[model samples]
Structures are given as structure tokens and as C-alpha cells.
Target: MDQIIELFRHLINPAWIIDNGGLYLLIAIIFAETGLFVGFFLPGDSLLFLAGFYGNELSASFHDAPFVVLMLLIAVAGVLGNMVGFWFGRKSGPMLYNRKDTFFFKKKHLHQAHDFYEKYGGGAIFFARFLPIIRTFAPIVAGIVGMDRKKFMFFNLIGSFAWVFSMMLAGYFLGKKFPGLKDHLELIVIGLVVVTTFPVLFKLLFGKAKGPIKTEAAKATEESESK
Candidate 1:
């Protein structure tokens, strides 16, 4: 039991992940986080950033190239991950809508993903890659809505490349310029989490839903105006 607990603790630690699993584990986590519904809790933004921060070390197996191989592999993993999620949603179809929530599933997230898809059309898949929880579900929702396979792949490829390179390169270049930046991994991770998550939380908590619901005050005002 203690060993299992300890392992999970280490799993969330980006430094430990790089030190232990290096390139392979990083790719697996990226795939799971984007592809698996239960994997929504896994670190995404921070992991990518840290992978970039340790690009040379992670990519040490590949000489002659610095961060190129690292970035490309991660990008492929991300793309493939979304494809899997899309396939799952496509297979599951509307049945997913009727399914009850469980420990690993939440109806609200599915609903939010649906709303996001409705509002953004096909771009939600691309945009959701930056948002944590939604990133996991956006591709699934794309499949559920029966988004064209070619169109989904279009956004999936571009979004995967964009997300991977942006996050990784940011860390890669910054770490290259400032060696001491690694000393503050906690701070960097926190900042990245806030930057990526705040928008999603904001949208969930405050973004307009499918239709406006009238407040008591709104109802009173409408009644008075009608009178």
C-alpha cells in the first residue's frame, strides 16, 4: 500500500518522471492524458515544460540533434492520443450522453466538452489541447458529434504540434538561457498550471451556458416591465 502511494506521488513529480522514465514515460503520459478519460488528472502542461527543460538529458540517447527528436516524439504521442479518444467517442456514440458518472467520469465534463464543441465548432479540439481537463475530453466530444475524420485530423495534427513545440520550446530555450531556472521547478509548474487552468475554470464557472437562465431578480424585473 505504501509503495503504491509512493509511486503515485512520484508520478506527479515532473523531475522524478524525467529522472526515472525519461523519454519513454513522458510519451506514455502524454498519450494517456490526452486519450484516456481517467487520465485527466495527469500532468500535461508541466510535464511538457519539464520535458523541454531537460531536453538534452531526455534526448541524450539521440545525439546530433538537441530538442528536435524530443519535440517530435511528444507531438506524435499527443496526436495519436487524441486520435484514440476520437475513436473511443466514435465507437461509444450517443450512448456516452446517457451514461452515468462514476469515480473516473463526470457528466458535467462531457456536457462542458459538448458546449465547447458546439461553440467552437472544430477548433475546440485545437484549443482544448491547452486546457487540462477539457483537453482530455475535447477530442472525445469531437468524435461524439461526428466531426469529419479528415477535419479532426487537421486540427489534431496542428494542435498537437503547436501545443508540444510551444510548451517544450518555451522550457527548452528558457532553460538554455537560464540554467538556474531548473532550481525553481515548483514555481514554474505552478505558474504553468495557473496559466493553462485558469481559463478553463473561468469558462466553466462563468462562461455562458447553452442558454441564459433567468435569475430571481431578472424574473422580477421582467414581470414588472411586463406589467
Candidate 2:
């Protein structure tokens, strides 16, 4: 357990990440977190933010690679990751989710993603990029549900660019201006996680899930009665 937490922490630390793998690590992590089902354990929001905040620190090492190129690579990784995830979901379908739950594997997230996709459709794909767990699963479900390829690509492209660019840019600019923020990097990551996680937390605590499920179930009952 301690080892797992430490691994996750090391992965989330922007300095450690860039120092070790430089740009490639960032691209790999961004792709895994956004595109792969097993990637839910990875932290995407904080990673992007830290990458942006520590952009100079990262690029300062690469000598040849410009800062903008690094950011673009991260964004592209995020985009491609979703494309990979979409195809995985489309091919695997819901049956892929039947495995038993564990610390790293939870079916609840799949249900939540399903509900979210059902309620919001394409919009979920765009906005999920901002949210945490939801972002990881949204594209997978979108594929499973047979969303039109054209529509999925359009939104996924838009969401990927927006999510990566915005978070990375925010970190870049703020880190440059504040200078002190680097010291609080861990806290900033935590804060970002909390903010990104609030949407799903709200649904779980405030009966949001029950409302949707009950409404749908009731409608089904009514249809049966009418028949």
C-alpha cells in the first residue's frame, strides 16, 4: 500500500516526472490516464498543471526542445490517448467491465460513466476532460454506446486540446509569475484534484444518482403498465 502511494506520488510530481523521462514521460502518462481503463489510478489534472507550472524547469534541461513543443506533445498525447480509449471501449464493450473490483479496479466508475454518458451524450466527452475519474471513463463508454464516429472525433479533438492547453498553459503562466507556487506544488495538485473531483462527489452525496436511476426505472415501469 505504501509503495503504491509512493509510486503514484512520484508519478504526480512534475519535477520528478520531467527530470526522469523529460517530455516522453509526460506524454506517456497523459496518454495512459486519459485513454486507458487501467489509467484511472494515474493523476491527469495535477500532472498537466505541474507540467505547465514547471515548463521552464523541464525545458531548461532539454537544450534543444522548445517549451511550446513540449506542451504540444503533452496535448497530442492526451488526444491520442482518448482515441485509443474510444476504440478500446468500442471493441471491448460493457462485458469488459465484468471483472471483480479491487483497489485498482472498480466497476462503480463504469456505472457512473455510463450514467454520465446517457445524461449528457457528446457534451460529457468535452467536459469530462476537466473532471477526474469521469474523464477517464467517458470516452470508453462513448465508444461502447456507438456514438457516431464523426461526432465523437469532433468532440474528443476539441476536448483534448482544450483540456491539455488550458491546464498546461495555466501552470506555465502562473509558475512564471508567482515564482513561489513551485514551493506549493503538492498542495496545488491536491487542490486541483479536489476541484476536479467535486462534480462526481456532488452526485454521490446529493442523491443525483438516485434521481436519474429512479426516474428511468419509473418510466420503464409506467411503460410496462401502459402496455
The models' CA-based lDDT, in order, is 0.82, 0.80
lDDT of 2 by residue, 160-225 (tens): 889988998998899889999778887888888888888878865663332212323345778999
- Give the runs in model 1 whose Cα sits over 4 Å from its true position: 1-14, 61-65, 206-227
Output the lDDT of residue 35, model 2. 82
| TM-score for candidate 1 | 0.83
lDDT of 1 by residue, 111-168 (tens): 7777878789889889989889999999887777678999999999999999999999
Off by over 4 Å in 2: 204-227
Best by lDDT: 1
Clashes of each: 0, 2
